[model samples]
Target: MGDDLVDLSEMFARFSEHWSPKLVARLNDYEVKLVKVEGDFVWHTHDDTDELFLVVAGQLTIQLRDRDVVLGPGQLFVVPRGVEHCPRADAEVKALLIEPTGVVNTGDAGGERTAIVVPI
Candidate 1:
């Protein structure tokens, strides 16, 4: 599929669930995932790796112990490794997540919101 291009808009239209991340592609040891998120996500931290969140549409707020980082479309934020953070969205938000392949969505705070990777 080297000649094929993955379209975010088309892929996002096929899924209707929230907080479920769908893997779009892989780059060596890392994976690029798309997630539809609404409401507040559980507080968690990835002890071994940092997570990059890029807002594809709508807005996202990453709550930290000291402050909240708000992001809109085209904005990006990287939560440093071992930093506790909770992601929340006031409305439906589409985002791209970049992290190591085996990293869990909820990190150490695993729950129903912990997404299992679904390759597209």
Candidate 2:
């Protein structure tokens, strides 16, 4: 279904205690998610699709195989398919993620940080 704005703040506020993800929107087969992230994520890679991370607030550092990408408010980055990456936010970071539906945050590597996608 197509939705505008989708009331991000209110949806985001609903899960203040959850560290996982909330579905924000869907464009064709792609899905957008809003998440409050802290600490470091595990090393993972999506073998089939590209993953986009857009900073909504705070800061984020994405560790890649060769270099690191540091993102701030209004900034975004795309980690291409099959590239190893890990996302880290020293402080609290809010972000919007866009990727094909069913692409897990942990990708092929699954563990405790695999976010449960809570539809908004």
Each model's lDDT: 0.92, 0.86
Residue ranges of candidate 2 with Cα displaced over 4 Å: 1-4, 17-19
Measured by TM-score, how close is model 1 to the native structure? 0.95
- Number of colliding residue pairs in each model: 0, 0
Over 1-120, each residue of candidate 2 has an lDDT whose tens digit, in order, gives: 255668766766777643587887888899888898898889999999999998988999999989999999999999999999999899998888999988888999999877878687
Q: Can you list the residue pairs that collide in candidate 2?
A: none
Best by lDDT: 1
Q: Write the per-residue lDDT of candidate 1 for residues 54-89, one digit (tens) a residue.
A: 999999999999999999999999999999999999
Model 1 RMSD, rounded to 1 decimal: 1.3
lDDT minimum window of 10 residues, candidate 2: 1-10
Name the regions of candidate 1 deviating beyond 4 angstroms.
1-3
